[model samples]
Target: MINYKSTLIPALLIIVAIACNRPKAAPAKGNAVWDSVLQNVQTAPVKEEDASECIKLNGQIQANEDHQAKVYALASGKIKSVNVALGDKVQKNQTLAVLQSMEIAASSNDLVLAESNVAMTKKNLETTKDLYEGNLATSRDYTSAQVDYNKALSELNRAKQVQAITGGRNAVYELKAPLSGYVIERNISGNSQVRQDNSNPLFTVADLSNVWVIANVYESDISRIHNGDAVSVTTLANPNTPLDGKIDKIYNVLDPATRTMKVRISMPNPNNTLMPDMFVTVKVNAQPASSMLTIPSQAIVLDNSKNFVVVKDAKGLHKKEITVIKRVDPKAYIQGLSAGEQVVTNSQVFIYQALSE
Candidate 1:
């Protein structure tokens, strides 16, 4: 009670110190000279540079369907032996499995008959030609022999073609890969009964050297995308690895369910790391804009359908309408802004509000 006056003086000084240390808010209405510095408003000059616009899309990694093959038994048979397992790498024309069937045996017999007929008819043609030259055979008889020889030759040619597809040695058929690739599927095993009419195939061999990136282009983005656009694909499993590719195909029709058109990009997968059905992000690089002027996105103010920016000049701040050509985050490519011009990057909304009033 004796130091009440001293206590009152110290409390008042503390109150005044707290008030001076607090941060000040930007004024509602003020000129650059009056309050811009006090509000800490900043400006940056417009710059010109070559910049690329990219559209990011979600897609999936798939085996290049064109470079893949489905192995089907040439004829109905029971699988005798499966020589390869799933994920096994195989070379072109490598035998993958062996099958045993009466159908295969019948094909072998037909090939043998065709061969025998060719040999027998060839001998007859030689004899008949000699007889005709010696005046011992009629012209019609020689012609008949020639026709038989031609028929036998045609049959033999057809048989050889069939035999290549339906390979059989002692009623066992060998299923061979058509291309060098890893085995993606194994539908048949030892002693499994495979049918020629079955919908499913025995194995799927796919060349993993290059893969397909299938992306869906929405209706809004379809007009901007074109074939041969550069694309970068990254997988979530290994985000550090990015694969480069190009758009090779854009389907003409739209998907009924998704209402998006499918686009295909070919990506090189030399390491065999990109697997089918892996989710990935595809960044399609659009044509670069040359010497476009850009400013910080925060400087531009959107009003209704029109956009404006606050320009600080010798006179003061003034609002100028601008047309945004493209926008990358934090920057906008605009038509009205000139290079070397100063525009407010922050606290522009305060200027916009005062100008609107």
Candidate 2:
């Protein structure tokens, strides 16, 4: 109980002092001043886009007339003449070379002889008939002469046809070209054994005025390609110049090995520039269905988890979060940012930092 009154009075006086002269707590980390500064520095407003277009794509160059051929001789005889050389231009029905062999000519001569003999017998039979009517010639004699004449007529007709070319006929022959084109290949030289041997071709010809640009289309895009679709192509050799063409055909079946479909395009190789088996790039333009919202790329700022744009929202000063679809040519095509929203175009990063604090 010693000094109880004294201790109670001192405690009450200390409480009274705290209430009368209380020290103010420190200011919070963020407040109105930071917001005001960000608003002052906000960039100029964003403008709406006026037009849209297709994306530029890549393509390749191709040869139109790269033909592969296999040739065989019709008449078997040692090769006589090979007029066309490899890579020589030839005309349609042009004589490539003349083949010489005793076998072919002999058949024709035999046919001529048979026809002459037939003519002689016909004259003799007429005389025999006249004599038989007079009874001056015996029946057996007349009959024998008639039978011999009939046999002669059949032999003469057979000779004219030249049926036995394999063994009976031997003569020089001429082999003519099937079409007019550049001779890409020739198996026969000055004198090679060309007795109907299929292992060799006399010559291979191709027309190269126009070229085919064959492109390998991935299976995913197979459905999008069709006949007459517009296409653009470029080559690694001459990438600066691009060629225009249309899809001539799209193969129905996909290649199992490459998982690609063959798309054929027809383009002129004027001055004969393009070649076969060259690798190239190809692009087919696909039509779009709807429109997309776009603006100059500088308007958007991305941070942490969300992309933001310093926008003048319902609240006097604030930052807006948006979704960016794609960035093309200093312009950002977006989905979430609506049309007519005023977005800060130039200074998004500084504003974001100011707003954060």
TM-score of every prediction relative to native = 0.66, 0.54
lDDT of 1 by residue, 1-357 (tens): 234344433433443344356633223344323342323457888899778778888899889999999988778888888999999999998999988988878878888999999999999999999999999999999999999999999999998888886877568889999999999888987888989898898999999998899998888999889999998888999987777888999998999899899899988887888998899998888888677888988888888889998887766566789999988757788888788988987656655554453
Candidate 2 ranges beyond 4 A from true positions: 1-71, 102-170, 197-200, 292-357
Alpha-carbon runs more than 4 Å astray in model 1: 1-51, 117-154, 289-357
State model 1's lDDT: 0.82
Q: What tens-digit string does per-residue lDDT give for candidate 2 at 148-217?
A: 7998888976775554423324476766666666676677766666676566667666666776777777
lDDT score at residue 181, model 2, on the 0-100 scale: 60
